[model samples]
Target: MMPNRVIAIGDFDGVHRGHQQILLQLNEWAASLHAEPMVLSFDANTKGQKIITDNRVKDWYFSQYGIEHWQVLHFEQWKEMAAEDFTDHFLKEELQVVGLVCGQDFHFGKDRKGNEFTLISRGITVKKLKSLMVEDLRVSSSMIRTYLEAGELEQAEARLGHPFCLMGEVCRGKGLARQYGQPTVNIPLSSRQLLPPYGVYAAWVEAEGSRYPAAANIGVRPTVESGGEPNLEAHILRDSPDLYGCEIRIELKAYLRKETRFESREQLFAQIQKDGEHSLTRLEMLK
Candidate 1:
């Protein structure tokens, strides 16, 4: 028999404060119903935009909030399913879901037809949560994305209720930074991840249980190479171990400057030194 669950459903991208409300409610409903608390989210938004939160980040959010189970519905396969069929087959029969919680704006199934009313009509207990607001503005993943794209890290982090972070495995870059005696750990940008504006940012990079202040650049290395895919590389401000192959999380604290090209390698490294010190000062101010 399928395990009984009380599920909260949404794209849950970024798992912002608004999403937290639904999760918190799900816990309450599950306790009363004697069912497991779970979250059911799609792999992407219905509109198929780049994802704000990747799997590692989502795992961190869920774990921190005591969410026990997470199920991902592939958007491409589930998008066209009829509303009634989705409720009967997917929610009831497959997942054995006894209760549902979602934001008031939540919609599901073909052409976005399903809603809290639909769940009630189908005999499922439903909780429709109101949208979370900050400073009279709705806190949403889309709004956070806009803030990030505009290089407004402070605004985005305010809504997220946590730092806006980039999580990925450290990869070997072209060794140019090391050649200049300014080593950095590089993380390749995923095509599916929504990125902040290409620029230098004062950041905190977490790796192997330690956090270091860093100067992070997110963009093509215009000064070194003609053209390449954008990648994130951070120079640790203090002495650090080799981080290649380790999974790391870079939490953006503040934007420092836009990316620029310099005429010579000496000029580029000199600017990098200045940026590193500036980042240290900015991070200290944030504290």
Candidate 2:
């Protein structure tokens, strides 16, 4: 039997504080009504803005908040759906949604003609939340992206209510860093994922449920190889199990220095040693 759900719907790009507020309310309502808490989100690619968090991390947030289900609607299939048909056919008959929670500015249906009123008219209960504000400014994914593009991690974190991170599977890379005794894991980046300025950072890596301080670089390894695309590489400060094929999350804590093209691999290794030390110190301070 399908469990009736009370859902919060939005893009929830970063699952920032504003989204968190709605999620909390969703849980409360679901508990009171004896229904499951679910989230209805759209794929990041469907939106105009570059994604702040990928599906993996966004789903992780839903799980953390005790949401039972996270549904990603296929934008192409649903874009032409009418407002009344959406509420009556999809939300009512299909998902068995008992209630809905959305932001005050939420819109839906073809041409964004649907709104909270549209749902209410269909006999669906709706809760709309106001935007979260930080220091007289609205906290939004765009503001967080702007902070990241400028390498303002603290500002981004303030809006996100957590550190901005890159979460993905570790991929095999040229073993050049290991040859220098500083082994690193490469995390392939998606073009749609918004990135900060190309640089080295003091980072925290979560692998196998353990968090380790790390020195991370985000850019093409100009001295070693040539690639137009940017990448993320992190060397854990402490010894750990191999991470290849494992999903890991690297949180940028502090920007250390800009990525530089050293004349020699030896020069790069020397600077990396310094970076590792600095990152270790920074992580300790953050604690």
Candidate 3:
């Protein structure tokens, strides 16, 4: 028998709560129909925004959710296909997709006209998961972005199904922490993705499969240095550790304070100590 499939399609930048709901329903539908459960997405990001998550992370997430078939169409090419053509050639001929799944707000095709109705009108079985509502707000990537911007770490994590993370190699830094404070693993945020506001945060630093609670800061350091670009600095609450040149992932857990200038070096050091203690307390609740 030809193996039919249920294709869940979306940008899925953060794979937020609503995406999780749709994927779960896709699994149920696929299982009942004895078909494959798949996710089809594009290698594109929303304009004027840094994504909360990216492709590599999504690949692992899909496997963890018991989904093995993942298809990524490039934005430039896929964007040109007409609504009817995508349903016919890609959905019907290539994927053998008997069932379709997407959020209620989903749109596709050359000019973003393919919606839930487009699939239904084409004799395809479709499931339009109702827009997820939480505290009277919609569950969406944009909502998660707002949570991050507002320094609402728990809310952001709850929506994304995981902590908002910054992953990069630990770059070298000048001796700001060498004399007055603790050494930190400096992770560059650059212009790569969207992030929380410039501030100190409660965090977790992961390296080589180990997780350590940490206090982190993200900003272009104004008080400590000059002409600094945006970056992430995580001071692992335990040992500062030998991390330069190594890669690590930091999870922002909660906001502690906004980035600020200090009157003196001693004053800056003292404030970081207080922020560290407060961050540790907040991170302790996570454990």
Candidate 4:
């Protein structure tokens, strides 16, 4: 049977805390009206422009929040539809949507000619969400990206309601850390994936349902040699169990510092010591 009502649409790019608020509202409204809460998102490859989060990662986050009935629609054809036509088609023919929930800055249709007023005028109920403020600043996906690019993981997590994460299968590397008595797990990054600024960070490493506190580095290892491939390597704290060939998720908790080349191995070791201490302290505070 067709649900009598549906909460319509939004970009939902990162699915950060601000986006969560809108989803929660939709869930509440849907329950009150005995309707289904639907999330209309975009497939990363199909989106007209670049986005901050990939489709898989966005879907993971949404699933974590218990959102079902998710729809990842292609944006290319939708972008060509006129504002009114797009709304008429999606609301009436496709979804039979009775209401819509979206951020105040939401825009849609060709040239983004549609607004909350336009939807309401079409006899569709619309809820325009006010900007969500966190820590005296507006919480947004762009702001989160800025913080990540600047190596401000803590600040980004504050806005995201969780640590910034990278997911990939473990791969073999030069094994330099192992030679130096600190074996690590390395993950190769694809070009389309967003990387935190080159630096060390405090992180939580998760694989197959278990999580561990760890010290991680994201950079070209300038100390060993110059012009090498950039890599992400994490040294799981005090644990020596095998993780080779496993898929792992790394949650960046706090930025330690920018990648630096030291004059001697002794100096580099001393800096790593400081980073380890800082990582433990930050992880404790987060707990």
Model 2: per-residue Cα lDDT at residue 247: 95
Q: What overall lDDT goes with each candidate model?
A: 0.89, 0.89, 0.83, 0.79
The C-alpha local distance difference test score for the whole of candidate 2 amounts to: 0.89
Candidate 3 error regions (>4 Å): 1-4, 121-123, 175-181, 190-192, 239-247, 263-267
- Quote each prediction's TM-score: 0.96, 0.97, 0.85, 0.84
The regions of model 4 sitting more than 4 angstroms off are 2-5, 44-51, 223-229, 262-274
Error of 1 at 153 (Å): 0.9
State which candidate has the highest TM-score. Answer: 2
Per-residue lDDT tens digits for candidate 3, residues 1-287, read: 65889989888888778888888998889999999999997776734377777676677567767889898878788888899899989898888888888888888998898887788887789888898888898888988988887889899888788888877788888778767767778976657577788999999998877888888989887887888888888888786678888778788888888999888878887888888899889988887
lDDT of 3 at 189: 69
Compared with the true structure, what per-residue lDDT tens digits does model 4 show for residues 86-120? Answer: 77877767787888888878778888888888888
Cα distance off (Å), candidate 4, residue 196: 3.1
After superposition, which runs of candidate 2 have C-alpha atoms over 4 Å from their true positions? none
Question: Which whole-number lDDT from 0 to 100 does residue 87 have in model 3?
Answer: 94
lDDT of 1 by residue, 101-141 (tens): 88868788899998888888998988787888999999998
Q: Estimate, for each residue in 1-287, the C-alpha lDDT of model 2 and write its tens digit.
A: 99898998778888899888988999999999999888888886456778888888898888878886889987778889998899999999999987899887889998889999998888889988888899998887778879999999988888899888889999999999989888999999998888899999999999998998899999988889887579999999897569999999999999999999999999999999999999999888977
Candidate order by TM-score, decreasing, is: 2, 1, 3, 4
